[model samples]
Target: MTAVQGFVRQIDLPQIHDPRGDLTFVEGGKHIPFEIRRVYYLYNVPVDAERGGHAHRELEQVVFALSGSFRIKIDDGREKSEYWLRDPRKGLYINRLVWREMDSFSQGAVCMVLASHRYDEGDYYRNYDDFLAAIRVAAE
Candidate 1:
C-alpha cells in the first residue's frame, strides 16, 4: 500500500510454487495496470553501472530484477523515494511524469522492463533539471 500519489508503487505478480521450481507469469492489463506494448531487458551490466536517469511524458513502465538486484530512486517533484528490486515476482511501476534514477546493480543483474509504449525519443525528459521545470510548470 505504499504508493506515491498513486503514481509509483510495487506490484507483485502471481507465482506458483513447486518442488522443482517456482513459476511466475504476467498478462497484459491483468497483472499490470496497462497493456504491455514493449518488453526489453538489460544484462551483463557492471556492478558499478548506472541506468535510467529520465522521465516519460506519456509512457509508463514496470521494472523488474530477474537475476540479481538494483536500486531505483523516484521523484514526483513534491517527494522522493527509493526502492530495491531484487525479487523476480515483484516490480516497480512508474507512472508518467515521474523522474527515475537506477543504480547500485549487483553483479550479473538482469533488469526487465515492461513498457506501455515503444521507444520514442520525444517522450523522454532525459535531463533532471528539464524534468523538474516541466513538473513545476504543470503544477502551476
Candidate 2:
C-alpha cells in the first residue's frame, strides 16, 4: 500500500503471444484485489488535455494504456507521484481516497480502466478541497 498516493502499484497482466497476434487479459478477484463492476476507455484526447481531477470515496480501479502512452499524477492529500502507462500488459492500481489527474497523452493514446464499482456521483469528491476534507474524516 502506497499510503501517500493511494497507489497500490503496477500489476502485470497475463500475456500470451501467438503467431498471429498477442493477447493480454485481466481477471477480477484473481489478479486484481476487487471484482470489476465497470469498464471504460478514453481515447482521442489531445496531448495537453487533462482528465480525472477528483478522488473516490470507496472505489478502486486499474488503469491501462491500451494504445500509445500517457501520464497520471496521483495525490492522496499528502504526497504526489507521477506514473507513465505505455504497456498494454500492465496496469496501475489505485485505491480509494486518492486524487488523480491524467494528462500528457501521446498520439492515439487509448486509456482503459477497470473499476470496482459502478457509477455513483455521491462516491466522488469532485473538488480537491472536498477530497482533503473527506480524507481527514476518513483518517479519524
Candidate 3:
C-alpha cells in the first residue's frame, strides 16, 4: 500500500463493481483525506504540454484521471517523486507547499481535481524559485 507523506499520497477510493456496471464515489473526510471545498477538471491538453507548475501556500488537493492516464511530478524542496494516476478509482494527493508539475497526459485524458480550500490567487506560488524559497522558510 502507498503511504501518505508530506510530499504526496496515492489513495484508492471505494468502488463497487458489477458485471453490468460499476459505481464509485468520493466524500470529504471519508475516502479523501481532507474536507473538500472546491472541485474542478482539466482536459483537451496537448500531449507535449504540461500543467501545474506551482505550489500552494495552504491549499491541498487530489488529482485523478477520470478518462485516461497522466503523470504527476512532485518535489518537496529536498526530494522529488513521480506518481501515475491511471485508474479512475485512484487519486494522487498533493500536500501543501509541495511543488508539482503534471505532464505526459494521454490522448483524451480528463483530469479531475478535488481541492481542500476555495480558489485564492494569493495562495499560489507560480514561480519555481519562489516555491523553493517558501519551503525553505517553512522548514525553519
Instruction: Report lDDT per candidate.
Output: 0.90, 0.89, 0.88
On a 0 to 100 scale, what is the lDDT of residue 13 in model 1? 97
Error of 1 at 134 (Å): 1.5
- Residue 35, candidate 3: alpha-carbon lDDT: 91
Alpha-carbon runs more than 4 Å astray in model 3: 1-5
Evaluate model 2: give its TM-score.
0.93
> Could you tell me every candidate's TM-score relative to the true structure?
0.93, 0.93, 0.93
Candidate 3, residue 3: CA error in Å? 12
How displaced is residue 113 in candidate 1, in Å?
0.3
lDDT of 3 by residue, 57-127 (tens): 88889899999899998898889899988899999888888889999999999999999899999999999
Model 2 per-residue lDDT tens digits across residues 19-128:
99998888898888889999999999999899999889889999999999999999988899999999999999999988999999999999999998999999999989
